[model samples]
Target: MTSRFMLIFAAISGFIFVALGAFGAHVLSKTMGAVEMGWIQTGLEYQAFHTLAILGLAVAMQRRISIWFY
Candidate 1:
């Protein structure tokens, strides 16, 4: 994907990551057990990692410094 698209995707993903994290902590926490909560946490962590990776890729692409790597 292009750098612009990657940046937009990363922004959206980051937004979802934060939203889901808050939802899990404030809303789901009341109903879910520790194990379920842990699962949510794990998923959010992965989402966060990927979001950052996408952001990095977008920056690299924009700078034209890591095109070959991508």
Candidate 2:
């Protein structure tokens, strides 16, 4: 059901986040300095966290109480 979809989406998002992180480190690191790298890492971390939060919200949405709140 929706829970399954949410899990799948979360997994995909996690994979993308890892890929982006690796790209930033391996490809961009040479061009950017430490501060720029830190910024890129922070942005990726925030995106990854929000993607998980979306998954959590989807799970919560499946509950009766959550539906009521929404």
Compute the lDDT of residue 2 as modeled in candidate 1.
93
Local accuracy of candidate 2 as per-residue lDDT tens digits, 5-66: 87788888888899999999789999999999989989998988988886786778666335
- If scored against the real structure, what TM-score would every candidate get? 0.94, 0.68
- Which candidate has the highest TM-score of all? 1
Error of 2 at 34 (Å): 0.8
Model 2, total clashes: 0
User: What does candidate 2 score on TM?
Assistant: 0.68
lDDT score, candidate 2: 0.82
Q: Pairing residues by index, what is the TM-score of model 1?
A: 0.94
Candidate 1 residue-wise lDDT, 11-31, digit = tens: 999999999999999999999
Overall lDDT per candidate, in order of appearance: 0.95, 0.82
RMSD for each of the candidates: 1.0, 2.8
* Clashes per candidate, residues 3 or more apart or on different chains: 0, 0
